[model samples]
Target chain A: MDTPIRVHGLTKVYGGGFRAVDALDLNVPRRSFMGFLGPNGAGKTTTIKIVTNMLSATSGRAYINGVSVMEDPKTALADVGAVVETPEFYPYLTPMETLHYLGELRGLSSCETTNRGRDLLDLVKLTDWREKRVGKFSKGMKQRLAIAQALLSQPSVIILDEPTSGLDPRGMVEVRDILKQLHKLDVTVLMSSHLLNEVQEICTDVSLINRGRLLRSGSVADLLDEVKARKIDVRTLRPLTPDMFDRLRAVPGVKGFAVTGDLSFSLDFEGEEDAQARLLIELQNLGLMVVSFKESGLALESLYMSLIMESR
Target chain B: MMEAASVVNNRERLPSDLQQMVTVAKYDVLKHLRSKRLLGLVILEALLLGLTFALPLLLGVDPTDDPAGYMSAFVSWVEILVIIGATMFAGDAIVSEFQSRTGYLLFPNPVKRSTIFVGKYLSTLGIIVLMLVVYYGVAAALVFAMTGGGTLLSLYSMLLACAYGAAAAALGFLISSVFKGSTGSLVLTFFTLFMILPMIAQLLPAGSIKPWFVLTFCGHVISYIMISPYPTDLVDSISLGNGEFMEYWTYYPDIGGSLAVMGGYVLICLALGMYLFRRKEMVS
Candidate 1:
């Protein structure tokens, strides 16, 4: 029940009066995986920046573990570690040396620093390249090193701004596993990504914002149930007549239906299991060649599109 | 209860913030040492000393013929070489970090910006001083072996050279922090040091602005040791007088005044650079 981070009515305006984020509020519980999902230019990154105290919030408040980022950033940031965009490091330095420098900044004892550095390098699967200069690292290698460094202080809340944007498929899998592993350690993770599937596969909760406004925020299950109450897709062997389609649409609890494809029809209802039995009976009575029917999980792409479309 | 107690004990060992800043500083100094840039600069000082002796021999200039005039010209050439090397080194120190995007990782830590600034600055100055010591050794050996006209005045002049070298390095650090790119910072530093500042000094009425050239401060400080009429026949081969002031200010030389001016210029510029860097948003 403890809130690790809270952003209240946050808004940001750029020069010449362009609003990037407006009237946004978010609450991330401690030790939860919170995904921030939106289309490009939807204020997802802006929100992360404001919460991390990188970009100034025009009118709002942000607190990290009850410490206001505005009132005391030095103390507030003490528990927060962030990797904004491409993580930069001294090219001439090896990954181990880079960690040693950052460890010092995080107050690690020399012995503890070396031990932690080696452990993290091994965790990121970079122990083999520990002494190699970072300049020679590929983009994926550099990103993995960045993640290890972010975890160096054992921060309570870790924020990653599109941490896996440009990675290859293998790299994305590596990053996803890394995030999942961190989640096991009781660390609160706030990640922003335009990749919907990445968010869908990993996040326990999500907050969607668009056009400088908060569209929706909740656990993936809650948001899915709220927006997808009556949507069901049924596949049949042949196209149905208009009268048969109308009858199905006029069912007591059915909200809507659409022939989305040649053999598949989308059925939307007013409530969960509202008329699910009645729906099956009607299709059976009509002697319709029903082949297969399925309910979609809370896929972020659908939720994201619905949220953005409703806002417009 | 035992598990809970162990967990509580684990949290107590976390490092405090000041300890972290020192660690970051130590890492930066170590990286510089490994790269051997400091050693290379010190070797430059040795090379300058060698040039002083070798050039005279190569051109066949008799040391006994006008020893004072030959010594003055040699001092100026060495001064120019020292200034060039120190400026280039200082200018690249901080700006290179920005260029490489390394500041993004370091600045976001729990440490204060001033800690990073002072740590890097002092480490760089240490390297310059190392070079100065080497230069001094070579200069002393050359003075005794080649001229046999060695005096304590020559030794003191070398120390003054080191002081001026430190000043130049500090000034370059300030400029490096202001400019964005390494190449741009270097070009601007050299231009300001050589072309612009002296030109401005020339534009002012002769005595009204000589102290403005940091090189002028060096010229004055060096002239005091080499030009002052001290009896060289003394057993200790040491004497002190107010001759550097005369060479620098000519008619209106003030040694304390020159030191104060140079000190003021260095302090103000460094303060301004730090303020600018602290507020700057690193886009890279």
Candidate 2:
């Protein structure tokens, strides 16, 4: 039995001929952290909603843990935990109470729910706000609580739709830390996000989708290897003037460049190590003292955009 | 570590349908209470009780005499309480899940949609019942204290009130299932119960047709049951020019018939409401 999250010819044509998800077939292997990556309106959320059984497909099928969602959602989703589209709570329930409510629905006893709730809350770092009403908490706090609830049932498969979306930088880090902890567990995670860096930090594999269709999918390393292009960040001791920007863009092997800070700019280059070394010498010839030069680590971002353009 | 394994094992086991309903009901009760909708209705009930006892004193009318008539005055107020309860608790039972996106949190669970509908319906009905019981309990005690006469008829009225509440709340749930926003559901449910149905009942009885199909029409049984001999329909006619007559009519609902009408609403409206709730998607 293939217990991975699988969607075959899954299509969702909303009212008025809007195809939110069009025959999107994806597979997240067992115990693999697969990033369902795409731009906004790329059918990522629509596919996730279908997989979670929150919305019916126009046609085709979705399965979670080897059970067909459209046929028997209750059983297909029994071992699945999903947070879809910026989930909101009852607002009146406290974090602890929310966990208990969800835990009981999953068939845990009072003692077990309590213990699991406490452990989950502690894991999400929401213990201090355990008794606080969710309505009074900020969006970040609610997002963190969402993580706690998703993991409360100890589900074998966890689905998160933009878990770090709409959070401040600090909140994103907090949620990322929790996600990192999940990566250590024996659970399968199928998280959807528009940002490549967000999933690249933790996901084992990624699927690039666009306009309701899957464009490409593979291991994180394989996808990165497919596109050797990178955006390198270079910080200088002295700020470059307007003319200096023109000269910097003209450097050999430097395909493009943008001003990042007063003393720094990012160079979009595609080349081997010899061309990259020549780039440093070119910058030195311009009388600029290089403070730092390194890759920003968003290789798949370039590939994602190029595929979206080609798919169109 | 051993305890952790046991906990994990416990979670893997799915609960029975009945257990899921109970769990959903339990949490729904907490939602209503924590939202203060239940408490607000109770406070309003207390105020109504206060007004019921106070209005008579201020008007210098003694409830001690004709205790049956005095207690019967509560019938109209109880009807209003039931409407308010239905509007507040049941009006948003299903719509809020979609409008607020809380469905994202709930719909993914292993529980069935029918189970969620019944559980929420029970919780809403339970609150209305509690409100009715408190109102009737006080009225009954006052009537018992004022006279040693039997308050048997008031019990019937209270039972009818609960039935009416159930029907009205089911109607509210139906409206909630149909509408997409809280305000729209609340306004439609309140007006449908408080004004629209009663007006229809009034107009229909003029044509010698009982609006027995209307739940609010049957709700009048709460007060009419208090009147002895069970009042029947009344008619008054005014002679126009040339001996033409214009007839005006007043209708009283029958206990058995009206109870059946309300029961039909409880079944049909809930069936329809559950159907819509199950079919509703969490899009947008």
Q: After superposition, how far is residue B213 of candidate 1 from its true place, in Å?
A: 7.1
Best by DockQ: 2
Worst 10 residues of 2 chain A by lDDT: A1-10
Over 4 Å off in model 1, which ranges? A9-11, A50-53, A56-60, A229-298, B1-21, B34-47, B64-82, B92-98, B147-159, B162-166, B206-224, B229-254
Error of 2 at A166 (Å): 0.7
Cα lDDT of all candidates, in order? Answer: 0.70, 0.85
Residue A81 of model 2 has an lDDT of 78
Supply candidate 2's per-residue lDDT for B204.
Answer: 89
The true-versus-predicted C-alpha distance at residue A281 of model 2, in Å, is 7.6
- Scored by TM-score, the top model is 2
